[model samples]
Structure formats: C-alpha cells, structure tokens
Target: MSENFDLIAVSPHPDDAEIGCGGTLALLSEMGYRIAIVDLTNGEPTPFNDDPQVRLNEASKAAKILGIERVTLDLPNRKLLDSIEARMILAKELRRMRPKIVIGMQGMTPRASPDHYQSQLIFDAAVFYSRLSKWEDIFDGLEPWRIENVFYYYTARELLTQSQPLQFTVDISTHFETKKSALLAYKSQFRAHPSYNPPIIDWIEGMGRYFGSLTGCKYAEIFYGSNIMTMNLFKHILD
Candidate 1:
C-alpha cells in the first residue's frame, strides 16, 4: 500500500524541488508533516552528470536532508510532453499518495527550461484527473481524491525574470541550512561541475534572504496559489 502525505511537490527534474522549495519542505518535515517529492525525470545526461544511478543517489541524499520521501517517474529529460498518458500516470500517483497540498512549478516559464512549463501542465491536469470518479478503474480502483490546494514555487533559474507577485511566503529561517544541505547534496549537478555554473548555493541563500525580508523573516520561500486562501484566525499571520 502507498503511504499518504500531507504535502507533495512535483518537480520537472530531480533537484528542482530542492532548489525551489527545499527549505519549505524541511520546515514542514520538522513540523511533523508527511511530505514527499515526485520528480518527473531523473535529470540525467547533463554536462556533469552522465550516470542515472548517481543522480538517483543524489536525489535520495537530498530527500534525506529534508526528511522526506522522493520518487522519480520514468519520464524523458528535456522531452516532457503534456499528454493524456502523462497526466494519467501522475494522476495515479496522486491517488496513491493522496496529498492534501500539491506543489508545482509556475505554469508560465517561457525563459526557463521547457520541461518546467510542461511539468506544470501535467500536474494541473493530474490534480483534476485524480478526482474523477470514472477513472477509478484505470487508476487501480483507488478512491477519488481531490487536492485541497495547489501552489507554485519559483526556481532559482527564474529568479532574475520572475514577475509574479507572491501569494504567500513561508518563513523557513530555521530550516535555511537544511535547505542548503539538500541542494549541496546534488554535487554532481551543481558543485562538482566547476564550469557548468557559478555559485548556485550563494544565489539560493540570497534569494531566501530577499524573500524573507519581504515578510519580516530571516529566510523564507515564496509561493503562488491557484485559489485565494482563507484564514479563519490571525494567529498564524507573520509579524
């Protein structure tokens, strides 16, 4: 039987969730939330990473750092397509995990990798498909499950050109270091390749601090929700 989760982050590649929402995941885990990340691709054949096994190991290590589970789907890297088959596969997983909150990349990322946008479409469709009673037979007869919330997390690659206003910010000040550790675990993709990219860790830290300043926190992560969120009380509001 599949384990249920309070939150599930859908990523285009193995390290995307770590790069975009690692601190948030770590904070949630510390708060005793059952969280998991589903990577659409293995993020292989990169400039520095040619071995799929190495990338898998790195993803596992990163998940451990955030105290969450990680599952990778058999999707082609750099060739993601938003089709019915793709949506059904993801929908099945959603039904199996039954997460209340679903996190995915922003839907309109024209400048970033195409896979990011494609991933958004896949998740968007899967969320709706997961709740279709007629598809229960196709999805292993699992009960229809509807996600309560769908949030989009920004990636470091889109930081410079991101224009979407933040719907809310998560105060991950305490889990900043935990996020860093998870990102650094992908040494093959970020640190090991000296010429592949600059100091991404520095950029991630700077981004966190910038977002935190906006919400009066030491470090934070921002997200956009598809629907307006209602708060019954002001106790959870940040200072």
Candidate 2:
C-alpha cells in the first residue's frame, strides 16, 4: 500500500476487480505499469464459503494470478457506510499508494448494493483526498496526491452510455485465456454464479468477443479515462 502504484483498481469484493478489468490489467502490466488492487471486502457470507479466511486466501491467489500487489480494507460484508472514519481509512491507503491513476467501480447502473455505494464513496474520496488540508494525524505531512486521471470501469452495466473514450480499447484476444485463468483464481465467486456454468474460460472468451465488436476487434477490453486522451493526426505519423 505504501509504494507508488502506477495503476490502482478498486473493487467492492474479491473477484470484482478481475471480472471488470482483468484484461485491461494484463495489457497495462505488459505495457510496464506498476499495478495494485484494493479489495474493499472479504466477500464473505456467500454460498462459496462462510469463513472469512477462506475468501481472503482466494483473493490472495487471484492477486498472484494477476501479478499485482493487493490490499484488503476488511470492511464488513453486505453492510458498508461512507462515514468520516471510512473515508479517512481510504485516504490513508491512497496516500500510501500514491497512485498516479485511480480506477474504481462505477456503481452507477446497479444502485442496489451498499457495497456499490461504498465503492463510489471511495472513488470520490480518493479523487479529492489530496486537496483537503484537514485530515487525521496519519495524513499530517502526506503531500496531496492529485491523480492525473480517474477512470470509471463498467461492470454490471450491460449498456454503455455515449461518451468519449479516454483509454484505447485493447484487443484481448491473445490474453483472453490468461484473463479467465486469473478470474477463476477466485474460487469463492465463480463457483456459485450460474452464469459461469459452462466454463469460466468459455464465458470470458464470449464476453471479450461481445465487447470487442464495439471496436472491430475479435476480443477487446474497454476503459474510460481522461488525461490528454486526444490524439494528434498527421499524414506521416500514426495515431
């Protein structure tokens, strides 16, 4: 949590990170970005397991599969509140990571889960954390970290709204298997989800194809971001 993370992906649960941005993470790691993942909860009380330690172990394995540092905030399962204390805890971690770019669940489409609301609250807090001077003693001398970009990842939402794409969609056809392998590492989640019936690998491949069709690729992963995303056009230079 203390290192300067070049890319930070926050998830409401263990597998949410991999499901939402696994391919993107692989692409980013290949491009040489130091990536980190933050899991807000242990994802307990699911049919997969009743023990918190079991879920944590699965998350650890998933992180290893994805090849990124992982941190868990240990928030309660199914019940999360965006209190000042919670915000401060998040701020402390953000300060520790010192990430240049922050990505989190949009939680925009599904307004049902408290975890979703918590994710949004974390996203908002991290965005403005560095600006405020008033904070706990933990943030005493921590310099304000103004992340260059904030990307809202689409997950649960079936329809993508019309908006400018800040991040280029990467064709994940080559890495589709790898992405699935990483996601399946979270045994607690995919084990129970009926949608993942046939096989996780097959499921991801189909998903990649569906998303890739948007950009003329056989398989692709999309991202929304904003940090000088525009490209310069020239006859000789490629965009």
**Candidate number achieving the greatest lDDT relative to the actual structure:** 1
lDDT of 1 by residue, 49-159 (tens): 778899899999999999999889998888898999999989989999988788998755665578888998999999999988886679888888988678888875654
Model 1 spans > 4 angstroms off: 159-166, 229-239
Candidate No. with top TM-score: 1
* Model 1 quality (TM-score): 0.91
Q: Give each model a TM-score.
A: 0.91, 0.82
**What is the per-residue lDDT of model 2 for residues 60-147, given as tens digits with 9 covering 90 to 100?**
8877777777899977768876776677667777787887777787654453356775777867786687556655455856766777
lDDT at position 93, candidate 2:
78
CA RMSD per model (angstroms): 3.2, 4.5
lDDT of each: 0.83, 0.69
